[model samples]
Target: MQKISPCLWFRNEAEEAVDFYVSIFPNAKKGEVLRSGESGPGPAGSVVLVNFELFGQSFQALNGNSDETFNNSVSLSVDCKDQAEVDHYWEKLIDGRGKGLACSWLKDRYGVAWQIVPELLPRLLIDPDKAKAARVMAAMMKMVKIDVATIEEAARG
Candidate 1:
């Protein structure tokens, strides 16, 4: 168990979101479901809270069932080893509904913001030579899905 976990407020679909999240990631699972009682905030047997793990990180989601929405102020940044890992997450999470934003940022179907960053990106962006780093940054700024090879080329040139 992690010392701190993010609690997501969902629009009455925490279980479905948890299932979708766990299904896409390796070493992920649905931990437990907390249901509403007969006294009822929601209908009896409705999911009120969900505990789940994604790639070993614990998270709790609440079935808020409100107008509150997920926004860009907070995000899940996925550190991928390579482009393939980045692509895998993008495809699985989006599944055609998510909007791809600049610089590897994406707003998924559930309105959750994600950064599909490749490990190579940081190394290139923080090179000892500021000019090269700037060039790499410029290249990255133009891309939605990061291309490691392109970043590397920008770093060299």
Candidate 2:
């Protein structure tokens, strides 16, 4: 059991969201699901809470309405090992309905923000050569889904 897990609130789509998320990650799995009981806040037998794991990270989804909603302020960052990994995740997460944003940020179909970043991104951004780092940043700024090759070429400049 994990000491702390992020609980996401959905408008009665917790189960669906969990399923979608698990399908995207190879290491993800569906865990326990708790349905609302009769006379509860939600309809009986409807999903109340769902437990799941994505890449070994435990998370819970709640099928309840709240004053708050998901925003770009919070996002799940996926550190990809290579360009292929970055492409895979970016495509999967932005699956038609989701919106791709600048600098490798995107929102999934469920409105959850995600950052599919390559492992080399940070190193390039923090390169000892300020000119190279600036070039990399400039290249990154123009891209929605980051291209590792472009970043590398920019860094080499």
Error of 1 at 83 (Å): 1.1
How would you encode candidate 2's per-residue C-alpha lDDT over 1-157 as one tens digit per residue?
A: 6899998889878899999898889989999998778887677887889999998999999977665678999899999999999989998888888999889999998889999999999998998999999999999999999999999899888
Q: How well does candidate 2 match the true structure in TM-score terms?
A: 0.95
Candidate 1: residue 105 Cα off by (Å):
0.6
* Model 1: colliding residue pairs: none
Task: Give the worst 10-residue stretch by lDDT in candidate 1.
Answer: 93-102
Native-to-model Cα distance after best TM-score fit, residue 32 in candidate 2, in Å: 0.5
Give the whole-model CA lDDT for all candidates, comma-separated: 0.91, 0.90
Q: Alpha carbon lDDT of residue 81, candidate 1?
A: 96
Best by TM-score: 1
Candidate 1 segments exceeding 4 Å error: none
